[model samples]
Target: MTLTHRLLSPLIVALAFSAPVVTHAATDPSFVLTATSKNFDNYFPSYLANGYFSTMTSVRGSEANLAYMVAFMDYAKDDIARPAAIPGWSGIDYSTGKSTAGEFWLNRTLLSDKAFSDYQQTLDMHNGTLTTRYRYTDDSQKSTRIEITTFVSQADTHLAATRITITPEFDGSVQLSFPLNIWAPHQPRFPIGKMTGDEMLAAVAANNMSVTEPVNYRTADRAPVWYHGDTNVSNDDGSTKDLTLQLDGKAEQGLHMAEAAAIELPKGIKPSDITLDKSTYQLALNMKVPVHKGHAYSFTKYVAMSRESWGGDASATAALAKKARSTGFDKLLAAHQTAWHTLWQSDIVIDGDAKVQQAVHSDLYYLLSNSTSGTAWPMGACALTPNYAGHAFWDSDSWVFPALLLLHPDRAKPIVMFRHRTMQPARERAIQYGAKGTMYPWEADPETGIDYTPHFAYGVFREIHVNADVAIAQWQYYLASGDSAWLKANGWPVIKEVADFWVSRVSYDKANDRYEILHVTSPDEAYDDVPNDSFTNAAARKALDIATAAATKVGASPDPQWADISKKMYIPFDAKARRHLDFDASVPHDKITWMGSSLAWLMYPNLDLPMSPEIRKNDFDFQLEELKVHGNDPNEMMMVMLATAAAEVGDGKTAGEWLQRNLVGFLKPPYNVRSETASNNAGYILATSAGFVQSLVYGLSGLRIDDNGLTEAYAPALPPTWKSLTLKHITFRGKRYDITVDRDAAGNAKLTRKAL
Candidate 1:
C-alpha cells in the first residue's frame, strides 16, 4: 500500500462514516535509512539482516514458559550416584547432578529425595524451515508419541519464534526419565565435569536445589546449560554415536544420576495420572541456535507422547500441534519479520550520517525481537536485557509505545492490549493502596502481575502516575490506529477508571483555588515527595482531557466531575529559575541532579508542555553541566530522550552533538557493544537505533501530532561538514510527506516537502 493511502484511508473512511478524524502519520523515510556501522555490526548483527534462530533468555517467568527439558542415563558411572565424566569440559563452575552424602563433593549425590537435575532447554528458528528430532525410550516398550506446535506465526516464509510449550509423558513407576538426545546440528556440552563422586555430591549439596519452587531451580540450572549451548556448541558432531560430549571436568566425571523412579499415585487412578498429570513440571531453555546469514531455519520438535497405560491419546495434542505447525507458528514469525520489514520499507532515510541509519535499524530490530503476541506482556518492558532484573516499568507505555506507534502502528496495538489484560490487577492494586481508581505498579513482575517496588524510606510511596501513563498510551494508540473497537472496548474502560482515580485523588487547594497532586515524583527521580508536581499535573490533565474526549466520542457521558477537577489541576512554573520546576517547589541543587536531564518530565507526549527556545538552551546548559555522569546509567533510553528533546527545540546542532556523543561515548569504541550495566553488560543494541529515530523526527523534521492535525516546523541544522539530507514518508496534517534538506551548488540551502 502507498504510504499516503495506508495512513489516510482510515481517517477518510471515518470522516465519511461520521467518525472523528485521527491524524496519525508513519515515520520519515530519510531518517529510517540503513547503514553498516562497526559499532552496530559488533553489537547487534542479528538486527542488521535476516537470520534463522534467535534465542531468548527468560528474565522473568513470563519468558520462561518457552523452553523444553532433556535428561540422560549415565552409563559410564557404575553407580547412578556418580556418572562418568566426558573429556575436556569447561563451562559454568556450578554442579549439575543430585547428591545425598559427601556434602562437600562437586558431583551429583541423591540426598533428601530430590531427583538429579535435568537440563531444561529450547530451540528457536524460522518456522517450517528447519526440523529437529530427539531420540529416547519409554518404560516397558510402550509407544511414545511426540506432538509439536508453534505459537507465534503460521507463515511459511517466517519462523515461529516465541514461546514453545512442551509436555512429556511416560509409563512405569513415575521415575525420572531422560528422553532428549540431540538438538539436531547442535550438540550439548556439560560445563561441570570430571570430579569424584564425593566431590560431585558436595557440589550438588552446596547448590541447594529446592523442590517447592521448581521454576527457580529450573531457571538456575537451565541458564548455565543454554549459555553453554549458545556460546560453545558447534554444528559438527563426528557421528550419531559420538554425540560430541564435553565433560572433561572433575565435577562431570563424578556426577550422579537418580534411579528411574516415578511418583506414586493413588489406587484406581490411571498410570497417566502418575506421569503427565501429577508429574506436571516445567523448564526454561534459552539456547542460541546459530543461523546462516541469508538462509532461514525452522525450529521443530515433538512434545513427546503420553504413555499408553493412561490411555495416552495424542489426538488433541496432535491436532493443536498441527494447527500451530500449519498456521500459527510460521505465520506469527513471518508477521514479526514482516513487521520489521514494514519498518524498513516505510523508513525515512537520512543521507549524510551513516551512523544514523545503522542506529535506526538497530532500534527497530530490538523492539520487534522483544515484543510478544497479543495479550502477552512485552519482554519485561526492558526488552530482553538484564537491567532491573527484567521487570516491566512505566517506560513501556510512556516511552516505548509512542515510538512504536509512529513507526509500526499494527504491532503497537498488542502492547496496548497487554495493558488492558492487566486492568483487573491494576484495580486490585488501587484498593490495596486505599485509592478510588486503578493504581498501576511502578514496576511489575511480568508473569505474576505482582508489584515489587521496594520501600526505601518512611513508607512505600506509590507512583500513582503509572495509571495515568497507561491511560494516555491507550488513548494515543486509539488516535494513531483509529481502532474504534479497541477504543470502545479496551480504551474506554481504562480511561474511565484512570479518570475516576484522578478525580478522587486530587485535593482542592483552597488558598490557590487549584487541584493539587500531593506527594508525587515526576519522571525524573531527582525530586521526590513534592506537592503539585508539574509533570504529574500535566499528565493528569492530559489524561483527563483524553478521557473526556474519548468518552464524549464513544457516546459515553462526559463526567462533569472531571471538568471541575481538571480545571483545578496545578502546573507549577518557576520564574526566577527561568525553567519549569520538576515539581512544585522543586529546589534546584548545586550538585544533586536528575540521572538523565534529557528525559525530564515535560518532554513526554500528552503532557503538552513546550520548551521555549530560551528554556531549551538553559535546560541544555544545565544538563551538560550537571547531568552527564559516566554515561552508562539509565541504559540507552536516556540518549533517545535527550535526542528527542534536542530535536524538539530546533537546536539541531545540539541534537546532532548529543547523538554523536551517545554513538561514540557509550554505543561505540572500546566496548563496541551495547551494555546492560557498567561491568557485566551484554550486547543489546536498541537504544542507539531509537536515538537515531528521535534525532530525525523530533529534531530536524519537527513533527508533532495533536487533535488539530500534524504540524511541521522546519528546523534542519546539520553540521558544517555535512552537505545534504533527504527523508521520505514523513507524516503530517493527515498526509504522507517526503522532505529533503540540501545545499545547492550555489551554497544556498533549501527545504522541500511533497505530499505522497
Candidate 2:
C-alpha cells in the first residue's frame, strides 16, 4: 500500500465560524476579517501560541492570560470569576469541578481605567506572529506609544516572549498600578483569572522569579520584573499612585512573598529608582530610563506558562521564561513564526473571496497555534485560555481532533497519546464508580483525573460516552496514522479498557438479544441520564468493532464477547420521524436539543451510521423544527455540525449560511472566535475551522476511510458564490496530497502533487 488514496469530487471547491453574543446583529454577511484589513483596536490581541500554551495581551495592551493572574474583571469589582486550578496552580478557591466551576480564568488588566478603554490601539496578527501598536497618555500629558511584539516560543513550548518598545513624548515616567479584581456586571462570577496580593507575590518570589534572569538584569539589558498587587490600594480601578512596599505592618501579611519580582524590564531601569511605595500583596512599576523625549527604547520580557494547571514551584515556570529571554526575543519570535509556517502544511485557497479566505486562514491559524505533533495537553478545550481551566473535554476528541486528522494527522497524535497517559486515572475513576472498565472524566485536567464535574452533578457526570469518545479517537488515530506500533503500544490499552467498561456497563436483556446502555447522557444534556442514546449505543458498538478489528491488525489477543456485544447493541430509531431516536422510540425527539442533538455528527464526524440525502434532510429538518423551542445557547460546534449535515443534503447554500451566521457575530475584529464565553476561547473556533474543512471532507467532498482504504468519495458541495476551494498539503496516513475543486465549465480539477 503506497497510501495512494484519493476522493473524487466535483471539479470545483469552496469553504466556512465561533461566537459570543454582544449587541451586534446584522443581515447575512458577505465578508469576514482578513490579514490586512482589520482594526486590532477593537480587540487588542496578538499572540505566541504553541498548542497548549499562549502568551498574549489584552485589548488594553497589557499582559493577560498568562497563569491567569486575575479572573474576570471590570471597572466595578462587584462580581468576579474565581480562579481555576492548572496543574501547578489552583483556581480562586472554588468548589465544583466542571468547566463552569473550579476552572482557572485568565482575565486581568495591569492598567485599566474607563478613560483608557477608548485609547488608540492597533494590532496585527498573522498565524503565530502579532504586533501591537498601543498609544496612551502619561501623567505629564505625554503620548506614550507601546509597540509590543509577541510570540509563543516554539523552541520552548512553555514560554511566550514579548518585546516592548516604548517611546515617550516627554521626560516624565509613568506609574503602573495593580488593582483589586473587579466583578463582572452581568454574572456573579465571570470566567476570568483572580489572584490577591499573597498568591501573586508568592508565585513570583517563592519560585525565585526575581533572579530568573540576573545576568540580563546586571548588564543593563532586559530583565523579568514581577508584580503582585496589595488589596489595599487607594484607587479601586488601578488608575492612581503607589509602587513603594508599604512597611506599615500590613506588609507582613505578604512577608512570605519576600523574593524579587519576575517583571522583565531593561537593566538600566532599576525598581529602586521608581519605587514610590509597595505592599507585599501589591506593588507598582515606576521606572525612568533617562528615556527622555523621542528615543524609542524597547525592553523584552519572557513568561513561562506550563501546560499543567500550575507548576510545582515558581522556578519551574520562571526558568523557562528566563531561558527564552536569554535566547533573545528576535530569535524566539523567528523560531516561533517559522515553526508555525512549517506546520501550516494544509491550507485552503478561496479565489475571489477574501473574507472566506481570511476566515479560513483565521480558523486554521488557531488550529495551528493550538496544536503540535506530540502532545494533547496544551490543546485544551479552550487552549491557553483560563476560561476552561485549560482542560480537555469531549471537544478535543469529537470536534477538534477529527479536523486535525483530516489535514494534519501528525498534529492530532497527542490526543491519543495524552489519553493513554491518563488511562490509569480512568481506571481509578471506574473503580470508584463500581464499573468494570475505565471511566474517563467528562472534563479533564492534569492535577486530578477525578471527574471535575461538580459532585452529584448528574447532567455531565452521567455522560458516560466520554469513555467511548476516547476509544473512537484512538481508533481514528490508528486509521489516519496507520501506525500499527502505536496501536499496540498505546491504542490497544485504551480500547481494551473501554471495552472492559462497556461490556460491564451494558445491560443485556434475556427476553431480547439486544444490549443497551442504561441511564446515560448522550450528546443532548437536556435528556440527562436517558437510556440507549442513539449516539452512545452506536459509539460503544463501533468501539467494540474497532477494538476487535484493531486487535487482529496489531496481533493482540481479542475478547470474544467484544464482537458479540457490538453485534447485539441496540440503537433506537423512530420510523415515523425518520430520525435516530433521542432516547428510545417512546421519547419525543422534538423535546431534545444540545450540542449533539444536531444529530448529523453520527453520520458525518462519527461515521457511526450511513445516512443518505433523504435521511440527512429529514434529520436536519427535524432538528431545526425542534430547536425553535428546545435550543440551548447557540454554540459554535452546533452551527458547524448543522453545516455539515446541510452540505450532505446538497444544500451548500444552507451550509455556507450556517457557517456565516457564526462568522459575522461569533467572531470579533481580527477574526478571533469565542466558545461559550471562555478565555483563549479561540479553541472553540476549531469547530468553525473544522466545519469548513470537514464539510468539504465529509460533506461536499464525501471523503471516508476504512481498513480497505479510501472507502468512499463523492461530489463536492461547492457554494454557488465561490470560485474554488482547495485543501493542500493534506497528510493522510503516510502520504501527502491535495484536494481542490474549482468552479469551471470544463477542465479536470484533479490535485496533482508531490511533496508540497
Candidate 3:
C-alpha cells in the first residue's frame, strides 16, 4: 500500500458517516484569488490579575484584593493536608499527589484568615468610588489605634495616594508594616525541599514546574517575633491547639498557624467580643482579651493601591491591579467585549447560517474572556474564574498559536513574547542537564518560573518535548509576522540554543543509521518515556530546519558538523501502517485510543507538516469514536483543534458538529453560561472563539496559510441552516483579507474577497 492509503484506513471508514460524493463543476478560479480584509475595533483588557481574585475598590474608595498568598512552605504541612487528597480539587489526583497538602485547602485557609479574609466581594462601579474596613485588637493594656485609608487613580494607570493614621490611648511602642509578597493563580510558589533561587529560575525557564520554591517574599526587616505560649486554634481537624502565639506588645507577628485561635479572656471581657478600638491593651496576646467594647473593629484597606505602597518598582503589579480594580472581575472581560464590538463593526458577520454566526461569536467570547495582558502566566483553562492554578504549557504555544496568529496578531505577539522572556531560563536548564540548548518546561508558574509538577508519574521528569515546542513557536511567529529583524535579534539566539540542546540530547542510533530522540513524552500524558516519538521527531526536525534557515540568513553558523547532524535526524513513519509512528519500533505502543490526535498537535497551529486527506479523515474518525460524554471530558482545547481540522479538509457538517459539541458540553453548560471545563476560564474563551473563527474561515471560506502563502482551495460550504457569511480584516502575510459568503434564493453560494 502507498503511504497515503495506510494512514487513511481508519479515516475512510470514519468519513463514510458524512461524506459527500465528489462532482466536477466549472470552479471560479478568479473568485478564489480575490483578497479581502477586515479590521476589528474591539480589544479585551486583562482585568483580573489571575481570574480567581478580583481587585476592586468599594464605594468609599478603599481597595480589597488578595494582598499576599503562600501555600504553607513547609513540606511536612503539605503531607498532612495534601491538595489532591481533598475532594473537588481539579487536576490533582491524590494517588499521584506529590504535595502533602493540596492547593485548594491552602487557598481556603488564606481566604478565611483575618489578614487575607474576603474571597469574592463585589465592587460598586458607580463613579470612581472604593470602600474597605478591617479591625484588630490587643489583650494587655498597652496602646491600640485603628487606622483607615482610601485611594483612586486612572483606570489603566497605576499611580494612587493612600491616607493612613494611627491613634493611641496610652502609648508604649508600635510598628506598622505591610506584606509585599503577592501571588495569583498559576504563579504559586514551589514547596520547600528542592533547590536554590537560581536553580528554580532555570527550571522555570524551560516550562518545567517540578522545582522547589516557585514563589518567595522579600522581607523589609529581618527581626524575629517573641513567642508567648501555645494558643488553642480550631480547624476541620477538630483539634484546638494548632498554634503558638507570639507576644510583641508592639512588633508584628507572622501568623502561620494551621487553625483558627480560641483564647481565654480576663474577668469581664469574652474572647469572641474582642474588637479593635482606641485603648491601651496588649496586642497579639492569647486570642482571649476583649480589647474593644461593643463594635467590630473595622478599618478600610485599599487593595488596588497596595502594590504601589513602597515605590515605582512595583509598577508591573500595580498596573495589573489597576486593570482588575477598574474593569469587571474577569481577565480581559471588558476588553474582550470591546474586541467583539470591533469584530462586529468590521462587518465579519456570517449571513447564510444564523447558528454558525452565534457559534462563531460564542467561540470569540470564550477566547476574549479567558486571556489577558500584564500577567506572567499563560491563559488558564477558564479565562473568567480561577479554579486551576494557571500554568503555561505546550498546548498554548502549539495548538492555540495558529488560530490566534492569523486573526489576532497583536494579541498573539505578547503570547510569543512570554516565551521570549523565559529563553534564558530554558538555556540554563539545558546546560544543567549537560545539553547545549534551551529546554521549555512542561508546566510553569506565571509570576515565578517555578516547576510545579508534583508527580513523576505524570512524566514531569521526562518532559524534553517542551524545548522544541518553544522553537516551533519562535519559528511560527517569524512566519506569520515576516519580521526578520525580530528573527535575527530575539528569535535567532533562542533557536540556536534549542537546536544545540537537541543535537546534544539525541543519540546516534547505530543500528538504524539515524540521529534519534529517545525516551521523550508526547503531548498527551497517557504515553510516557516512548522512544523516537513521531511528534517529537517531527518537531525536532522542523525546528532544526527553521533554525538553520533563519541562522543562515542572519549570518550565524554553528560548527560545520551541525549540517550533517540535521540531515541525519530521525523521524519515524510506519511503512506498514502508513502513518507517523507514535515512537520507534522497539517502544511499546498502547493500543487504547486518545482524543486530539488529528489536528490538536499537527494541523491547527503547529502546521509542521500537512497530512494527506485520507490520514486526516482517519484521525477525525478515531477522535469521534473515543469521545467521552461526561466526567473527565478531554481538554476543551481538543474541540478547537478538531473543528479547525474539519474545516481544513472541507467537511462543514463535521466542523459544525464539533463546534456545537464544544458549545453545548463545555462552553455553554448545565451550570448556566459558565464554562464546563475545569476552572481555567480563559481556556474556554480562546478555544471557543478560535473554533468559531475556524468555522467561518476554514469551514466556509476554506482559507489556509502555509509556507507558500495563503490558499483558498474550497468555496462556501454552508451548513443546511445558513444563508450568508461575511468576515473582515482577516490577517495573513501581514495583510488583511476581507471576505463575504452568501447563498442565493436557490441556495447557490456566492463568494467575495478584497484586500484592505
Q: What is candidate 3's local distance difference test score?
A: 0.42
CA RMSD (A), model 3: 17.0
Cα lDDT tens digits for candidate 3, 1-756? 111111111100000011111111331111011100110111111122222122222211122222111111112222111111000100000011113342211112221223222211111111121222222223232222333332223233222223323333442223222212112112233432244434433433333233354421111110111001111111121112411111111001112222111121123533332232211211121122223333223211122321112223223333443444344222223343343345333434665544444445434433433444444335532232222233455645654455566666655565566677777766666667677767766555443344543331245546577677778777777877778898887778878877887788888978977888877766554556777776777777777777777787688775454566668977666666555555677865444323423224555545435577776565555455545421134545566667666666666667667766665534332111223232222222343455446556555666655455666655555555556667777776678877777666776656777889
Q: Order of candidates by TM-score, top first?
A: 2, 1, 3
Q: Please tell me which model should have the higher TM-score, number 1 or number 2.
A: 2
* lDDT tens digits by residue: candidate 2, 1-756: 000000000011011212211111331122223222123223424344666444444544444333322111111232121122121110111001113222221123223332132333322233354554445543323455656555665555656655667666666443332211221212222211244323423332433444555321112111011111121122211112222111111111211111111234565664334433333333333343355677676665455543223232344544555556567767777786566556655666665565666666666667777776654342555454443334566767876787788688877787778788888889988898889778898766533343444222335657777788889889888888788888899999999999989998999977888898888776766676678888888888888888898889888888999999988998887788677666776555555243436465566665546666677678788676666667744455567677777766667678778766656544545445543311113233344555555665666555666676544444456666766677778776788777666654553233223454
Residue 596, model 1: lDDT of 43
Regions of model 3 farther than 4 Å from truth: 1-348, 352-363, 369-386, 558-569, 585-600, 622-632, 668-701, 713-718, 732-734, 741-752
Error of 3 at 542 (Å): 1.7
Model 1 Cα lDDT, one tens digit per residue, 1-756: 011101111100000011111111343322222111112112121221121112222111011121111111121222211111111111101111122321121112222111212211111221111111221122222221212222332222122232222222322222221111222211332222233433433333344465344332211222211121111111211111211111001122222211010111122423221111111121111121222222222223212111111112234323333444345343545665455444455454656776655555445555655553343454443344322324455656765566666655655566577677777877888888778767777655454445544222112243467777888888877776666787998989989889988887888889988888887764554455667766678788888888889998799998888877877778776688677655665545333332444224466343446657777556655555446652224444455555656666655666677677666434422212343222223344333344455556545656555665544543555544456555666433235666666666775445676778
Instruction: Flag the better candidate by TM-score, 2 or 3.
Output: 2
Global lDDT of each candidate: 0.43, 0.53, 0.42
Sequence-dependent TM-score of model 1: 0.58
Best by TM-score: 2
What TM-score should be assigned to candidate 2? Answer: 0.73
